[model samples]
Target: MKHTLYKHIQEGKTTGKKSFAVLVDPDKVNEATTEQLVSLALDAKVDYFFVGGSLVISHNLDECIRQIKVSCSVPVVIFPGSHSQISRYADAILYLSLISGRNPELLIGQHVISAPTIKKSGLEVMPTGYMVIDGGAPTTVSYISNTAPLPADKADIAMCTAMAGEMLGMKLIFMDAGSGAKNPVSIAMIEKVSSHIEVPLIVGGGITNPEKAYLNCRSGADIVVVGNAIEKDASLIRELSDAIHSVPVRV
Candidate 1:
């Protein structure tokens, strides 16, 4: 079945709830560990699974996605870092444009390279406006993408960047703090962006606890993505899911 992420978000809104997603970076975990993680995530009642990495130095991207798709019942989406990460096995891809960075490579260069392959794969393409916020530390994404992050204190700049993306016809806005961040994207920043953008807002990175996830949702984030946190303690998944779901839906 073809999965529509936008439809899922609308359904959540209609049902008056928020959703939880878990990110699985294949490059970071071994096969045995990945299998266990998939099982744990499935058991946790996570709404979706996102698979990808900033640097997939491993040539096993396709194999890793295949395994996860076969092992888990939840929808598996590709949160790709580069064009090379595309595969037919996944349900969809977050076709991201790094709007926050001045680097033209991430903004349009990579998309041009990946477009043909993506069209051929017949995967659902979710046009996402990606904005990286300062995480209080240097992160893999910031280093590899060669783009400086927007200062965490600068909510106004972030707002304008996101609005520009929406005007450019992007479907969703993802505000990320980069994995293993010293601090997650602030609630103030999330609130500012969420209030401005008409598209669904997805907040991620450094969200290590249920409280943090809950706070993001309460601040108006339409979806919350958790990665490194669950990798360390798989058992926290259920708690985080419940916490995000506990927030009152925005009217």
Candidate 2:
């Protein structure tokens, strides 16, 4: 089967609808908890399930993905933090390049190391430019990657970085504020980048409610991802899905 990430985004574009993605971090949840979360996400009509985290402390990634795939019908996309996170069972991988930081390791080094395996696995490779914005708190991604985030207040710099990624042939742009962020990316910054980028835009981190998700959609985020929030209250999945899907698309 083809990766559902591309299919879901295409479907959203065709229907003039926004997409909802639920992120699953293996390091954060155990087997039983992960299964329950996947079931809840599917029941809530989540458009896609993104697996992977900054730290895959557990070696059960493959098994985790396999179990989740069997339990849910939604597409599972690997939002890998490193090349080690790749698995054939996933429908696709967000071949990410961290654009906000100057660290060459995340920008291209990791991609080069994993390219052959990724190609051989036949997983859909969605080239995504990952941009991290300062979210007021230190996130695991920042600490582990050894990179600094772009200033949240600097829209111009963020725009430039996103444009560079686009020029580099990236298919998508993901602006993250980090998991459990103190504050999410500002609407002003999202608007600035979304207005300039033609590719799909995904925003995540620190979004705790449907209202924030709705704000992101209105500000032009093609997809809104919620992880910690849903981890706390799986029931919020339905509310978030409804909120994102209810946004009025521009005619």
Candidate 3:
């Protein structure tokens, strides 16, 4: 029932303080890289570490969270890809409902199977509306979820979906372009959605550089997440984090 992570995000939205989150996929990072990431995150003062991925084929999820916990004070949140991705080690979980797709399994089916376990795990649950925006490529998330992403250019659809999620009482709205995306979500879509929703807005995928991260925050994303890009070049962490945190909070 703790609202620590959610409260921080809500406050950030209210204050117009943009947050930068580093997405760490257990399948992609080893202990060494995770340690390296921890060091960078501490230096950059990252807001959160999102653990999990679209298709995690490894058994390192728990250990990944442990490693992060022992290394830094930054919050660790599970951006779970499936029911099996839950971990007691993390501080919080984004209990995502895939609102952008018609797949019943993603919207509610997965939640049912995971709810009991999540409750038992004692992780702070963040009811999130997860919308996957087309990232100009066929990414793993679309294939694994068995859902098509919202078209990149369709701002209206994205806006309405976010509005519906907010009305449904979801605590957060996450719009992702999917990892390894060729293009991030459009500014127009982000602006449209953020303007409509009262909850904090999260935008991720295809945000490879500080400039892109800065733009996303300026466009209205309260939190910007990056993963694949950091996986390839760990040095970008500071730049990306700095860029996101530097945006002047809009009044």
Candidate 4:
């Protein structure tokens, strides 16, 4: 693995720079919209393109990734929902383990099944500890994984889970509130978890506006991912990216 994408992330963390990733749910966007999003991203100089979703039933993953690669040089990372979500067209894969939930499948079971294939695919495998925090509603991830999210207000739990993930050798820590979250992950939660972890912290879900995206970065999120918001309004991409990049590099 070249570790190109991971190196970019690591450098950002080391330099206190913030990144903005556009989460593209293949099931939601068609070819035309994807082109539009890629064009906007190219103009915005977006940091990364996260392609996947909890329930991507449309079978558009490969083409979606191919389209992004064709349109821009930005790295495309597969945010797989399951073992079946692998694709050779992507630049990297977030090998996620659901540390926040007790589900064996998400934690290790699916990884076991996907490991060999992932290894052969040549996608830079980023071992990510994925935490699902309560987003003030029942999310598809909670239902599909059959696991409950950590309580929204429980910063202690979030912090400990992230620390455990880092200790367990996770290359990155991602805390998501799930798609279309009623409330984004609290700034307090991001602060507590990021302060304790050495790895880069990624925060996503329900971040709709530039202010919220910027706040998430200021609070310690190395990467702020936005999907549902962009699905509704692609124009928000530039503004959101600007907001995140506007955060002063931490000293």
Candidate 5:
């Protein structure tokens, strides 16, 4: 399967319909919890499940993915924080490059060591440019990646980075306001970056409510991801889904 998720994104782009994805951090939630979330997610009609964390201290990933697949119909893609997070059962993996960071390790070093194994996993690989925008907190992704996020006000820099990612043949561009961010990526930043990139733009991190999600879509984010907020209240899944699907404004 050559990452059908990308095709779904493209179709959304062509149709001007927004997409919603739920990010599940294995280290934060358990199997039982995951199963419950699956039911909620199904009802919410989420487009995808992103599994992984900056530091995957949990061993339940394989079981978690298996359980989620059995109950959920949406594609489960691995949003790996480390190469070890790969699960063969996943529909695909985001082959990420931290384009906003200057660290060689994240830029290509890690990919070098994990390439051979990934090629054999039979998992669809989607090359993604990952950018961490200042989310008002120093989150684990920033700490672990050993890179500082671009200032939220620097729309020009974010735009250039995203454009660079597209020029380098990336299939998608992901802008994350680090987990538990007090503030989500600014709408201006989203607009600046999205307007400059042809590939799908996924905005996540600190999206606490439907209003924020709606504004993001209006700002040109093709896909909006909700994670931390949903964990606090599973019911937000349905509301978020409605917000993303009910309003399909193209910016």
Candidate 6:
């Protein structure tokens, strides 16, 4: 693992720079669609491309990754919904743990099954702690992981969970509202969790507009992830880039 992507994230932390990542689920985006997104990402200065989904039914993950790598300069990080989502074509993998839930599979069982393969794939494994917050609806991630999200207003629960993840040595912390959520993670939750953790904070799901994306960054998120929003409106990429990068990332 060269860690180019991880290093880029670290540099952002050091310089107080915020980043934007566009999620391209292979189940959702094809090769042609991926090329188009990558082209737009290059122009928008999207810092990373997150490639994966909760239920990856498509067999074209590798092909999509290959096309994006050929078309873009941004790092492609594997946002795996499961161990089966692995691909060496990516620059890195967010090795996630569903710490907000007690599901043994997401926490370590799946990792146990996939670790050997992931080790062999050579993708930069970023140990990420994944927390799902109530997004005002039932999300695919919540359903798939068999875990309930933390209450939207329970900042204390979210913060303590993130603190536990950091103490356990996670490299990154992700606060997700689940894809196609009715709302993004609340600004209060982002502030509470990020203030306590030293790791880079990533917030995603249902951030449909630049305003929400911008607010996430301003609230202390180091990275703002937009997927369904981009899939709905590719033009939002540039605006979201401006929104997130507008505020300096502060830990």
Using all chains and alpha carbons, the TM-scores for the candidates as numbered come to 0.94, 0.95, 0.98, 0.98, 0.97, 0.97
Compared to the true structure, candidate 5 yields what TM-score? 0.97
- Model 2, 107-166: lDDT tens digits are 999889999999899898898999999999999999988999999899999999999999
Candidate 4, residue 180: how far the Cα is off, in Å: 0.4
lDDT of 4 by residue, 1-251 (tens): 67988998999999999999999999998989999999999899899999998988998999999989988889999999999999999999999999999999999999999999999999999999999999998899999999999999999999999999999999999999999999999999999999999999999998999999999999999999999999899999999989999998867
Q: Candidates 3 and 5: which is better by TM-score?
A: 3
Stretches of model 4 off by over 4 angstroms after superposition: none
Local distance difference test, candidate 5: 0.90
Q: Give a tens-digit lDDT track for model 6, residues 1-251.
A: 56777877878866779999999888888767777888888998989989999998979889999898887667889999998999999899999999999999999999999999999999999999999999999988998999999999999999999999999989899999988999899999999998888889999988999999988988888999999988989989999999888895456
lDDT of 3 by residue, 1-251 (tens): 89988999999999999998999999888889888999988998999999999888998999999999999889999999999999999999999999999999999998999999999999999999999999999999999999999999999999999999999999999999999999999999999999999999999999989999999999999999999999999889999988998998768
> Candidate 2 at 217: error in angstroms?
0.4
Superior candidate under lDDT, 2 versus 6? 6
Local distance difference test values of all predictions, in order: 0.88, 0.88, 0.94, 0.95, 0.90, 0.90
TM-score of 3: 0.98
Q: After superposition, how far is residue 38 of candidate 5 from its true place, in Å?
A: 0.5
Per-model RMSD to reference? 1.8, 1.7, 0.8, 0.8, 1.4, 1.5
Which scores better on lDDT, 1 or 4? 4
Q: Clashes in model 3: which pairs?
A: none
Assess the local accuracy of residue 209 in candidate 3 as a C-alpha lDDT between 0 and 100: 90
Q: Choose 1 or 3, whichever is better by lDDT.
A: 3
- What is the alpha-carbon lDDT of model 4 when measured against the actual structure? 0.95
Count backbone clashes in candidate 6: 0
lDDT of 1 by residue, 1-251 (tens): 24476688767755557888898888777889888877777777788888898988887778888888888778878999988999899888999999999899999999999999999998988899999999899999999899999999999999999999999999889999999988999999998988887788889999999999999998878789999888888788889999998887657
